[model samples]
Target: MSEQKNTYRSIFLWGDKKIRPLEEGVRALVKEQFGLTEADLDQKYLYSDDEVKLDIAPALSEKQLNELQTICGNENVKTDDYNRALHAHGYFFGELLKLRKESIETPPDVVVYPKDEQEIVQLLAFAEKEKLAITPVGGRSSVTRGVETPQGGISLDLSENLNRILEVNEINHTVTVEPGIMGPVLEKHLNKMGYTCGHFPQSFEYSTVGGWVAARGAGQASTGYGKIEDMVLAMHVVTPVGIIQTKDYPASAEAWDLNKTFIGSEGCLGIITQVTLKIRPYRPKNTASASFIFKDFETATLMMRKAMQSEIGVPHLFRISDPVETETAFRINGFVNSMSDKFLKTLGYKNNSRCLMFVSIEGDKNYTLLVKKRMKKLAKKHHGFYIGGSPTKKWLKQRYESAYMRDPLMDAGIMTDTVETAVPWDKLIPLWKAVRTYLESREKSYVMVHISHVYENGANLYFTFLSPMKKGDEVEDYRVYHQGLIDTIHENGGSLSHHHGIGRALAPWMENEMGSTAMGLMQAVKDHLDPKGILNPGNTLGLRSKI
Candidate 1:
């Protein structure tokens, strides 16, 4: 383990735990998991000042303040005038945002809570008239710095007007919801109706439908259900000119459904108000998450690829833990009384191996059993051994419950984050190697890669980077590390982003990805709708001179 600041030592579900009497597979899993040892258990992690840092907020200019007030103009609206509204801003987690000084020093000039679509229309019109840029804000769980308001702009908080469920079409098995409605509320409503949204991510608790759509977020169950872009049937986005509602829900083949374009637009195009999504009857999920020890990262990656493309069967969720991540999950456990470190060591697993894959098959029992058998056979191809039903199932159960145990690490202020990108199988291995080479070169505290979400044609390889930031220099480390990852992604021919939007974080790469001609079309579309460039200027675009 390296010196990490504010970085939480990952309590490897079994990764870091010292074990004696470990057999071949268990010892292999431990060795493959992480580079930590019981001797290094008390290693201090560093937190980045950048991690806790935000822009300095100057007092709003008279023109900016007045313009924001009129742009809102909602009688009871909370601008800086009629009402002082509570502000919600920051990354996905609220741990840092709740700090008043952070929000105040880095405050948004105005937070408008419009109550209806007409208000939204009026606001956009007002911004256009005022020649001001407007940033569409949702649950404010954005980590890509996506929701941060640039200097001199209006932060349009859509919570008030976009929180209603418009229609629940039982026949079509879909639900139409206001863009402001966050996931937890919507999920509860659906569960009561014996239906489920079928999407669960770490931010699901606080993220909104519109935010998810705009970001093209992936659910944990994306293998079976699909990403937000796939689940969205239709959306009513407010263009700069007027409200542009898709012709019909679920789209029609008569012409291209332009709505698909906005699903991952990242608010570069317009503000989304209402979204209709395909839903299904709630089926109780019976999941079996187990782990295995692999000789190396290549073997685990290959096994994951096979399972994802397997015709016989595949689990809905397949996550592999690199040696470091496995170690973090296991060794960092502060509460390990029953399992002795000596026992784990005896399992033939060295303190270091290459990898371990966590797999979960969920659905009807009969189908899951069949899938499990098929998956086991597929594993045999990779020389993978499932420790029967040992520590694996318990590991998967605690994954989503990460929130409960994650706060301590987060509170420590480490530059802790994960980056994911989907690449075709051919390029996947190469990209993974590229990422590893970059991280390893930096000599950071911990760098682990996993195939969290998989697909038939291709799959997503997610990398979690945990580094200790030097005091007063977190920003530099973050900038260097992030640039390395982004640059490597470009060089390796992988998307700079997969689930997260290309907000300002990825804005630099958008042109390269979309190319000149396609980028021109986006500009043309923006010009046709928002000719004045009043909405989210400088996002998802390089130049709008022609458009």
Candidate 2:
């Protein structure tokens, strides 16, 4: 096999281990936004150590190590400093700060690669007996610190061996797969069978099917394909108590929906061993793309709400960027002074005020064409100018690439992050203004907002903010900003998170968001399933005091 270029040691960096240089246009945009000169940009904001050095040692004894080796093979069980360091924390900004400085406080005692469900069952049993915390790691793509091994027992590395497409049910239009299967692997396998899962999150290249189910994640095309929860038909989870397998039924009045109990559990309830999801036939020829320029963010949202409620059909990828984001998009994509720019200006679409919308419909040719036509009519009725499908195509081509921009920005003395929340149509405008206002209030900050995964009653507002990094106080500054953003979202009547699950980052706010009674109920479920509290100690639900 060819050597792997990217590994967990370089988790601080995005994609490959190599540091990607910022594009000239992006660098210029950053400088303009942050009021920085060429000399200011020359200074590196963050520095990552070349060598992995964590002083912490494994807590597991030789006997315990042998026991794990017995469950998995000897080669599958790892105790090296690098492997432990790799599983110490996730891709959370705070964790990245620590990784860059090689200042990890706690590292997992051992990393285990279970080959199959049977091995997972055995490992869970062993963990229960030994009272060891086990954090199920899929792709290590968690930005919420969801995969951190705070309790330092074991890091269950599923992506190693427990990754395979188990079955493809053509008649039922569903596919069953092992939980460790990454999005690209599963999608490729499904595409070969002329079907698609239709879930394409920005982290699609690195995230896993189990991670999606565990976090209740949504893809970029969620407006049409629905979120991961909607696609998951059945699940087989291995809790500390026992295995709970939900039946695969189209619709059922089944007792209490155990599937939901574990869907967003974040490995607190159990480890998702296997999953069966609904799949759609691949129909790229039937896909339709369209773009529109609205006078402002509010107008674009109004048109989106109308389109969603019209019952005509929602687009597979419906998105509207607020004025700031629209301006940023224009600048970064070199849309300024272009023919499209002059044409838009001629039609009263001015920069810094005009919002940009991208629409994509996927279905049968007739259905897609009909939806596109009706959506276009709605846009026109709302004074939206049709800007052709080129923008949408451009966005589709660079959707995943945008995530890589964060690392380069961080390297150039700039701090960048994203926070998303969902709100009803009535509260969308207020929430948008409130969060945007708070973010922009910060000094040297550039805030961009966008609406995606739209619904009839509401839509998701995703905010991307960039500011000058406080070199020595990166994590502390991040905490302040992150907490303020969460508080603002809560105060403005927005969901804590739309797609990203309540990992450790959001665990503190769970009670405030879900209420005390609801939290108690969830706690009860967690206690019953994980009496020993060995599965992901500090995770979505909250920090557990036990093992």
The best candidate in terms of TM-score: 2
Stretches of candidate 2 above 4 Å error? 1-9, 543-545
Give per-residue lDDT, candidate 1, residue 131.
65
**lDDT, residue 343, candidate 2:** 87
lDDT per residue, candidate 1, 1-547, as tens digits? 2323221122111122122222334223333444434333233333222223334442456665566556456453444421111232344222232331233333445667777788788878877776666778787667566765544356777765669988888999889999989887899899899888988877786778988998889877777778887888887899777787874455578576677878877776789988989886675655555667666667777888777766776676677776666655555553122354345445544445646676667667787778778777777788776755446676645655554333323333444567788888889889988887887776545676777777887788788765544445555556667878888988898877778766666777778888989888888877887788766665543534221
Cα lDDT tens digits, model 2, 61-88, are 8999999989899999998878888888
Total clashing pairs for each candidate: 61, 0
**What's the C-alpha lDDT at position 405 in model 2?**
81
Q: What is candidate 1's local distance difference test score?
A: 0.65
Q: Against the hidden true structure, what lDDT does model 2 obtain?
A: 0.87
Best by lDDT: 2
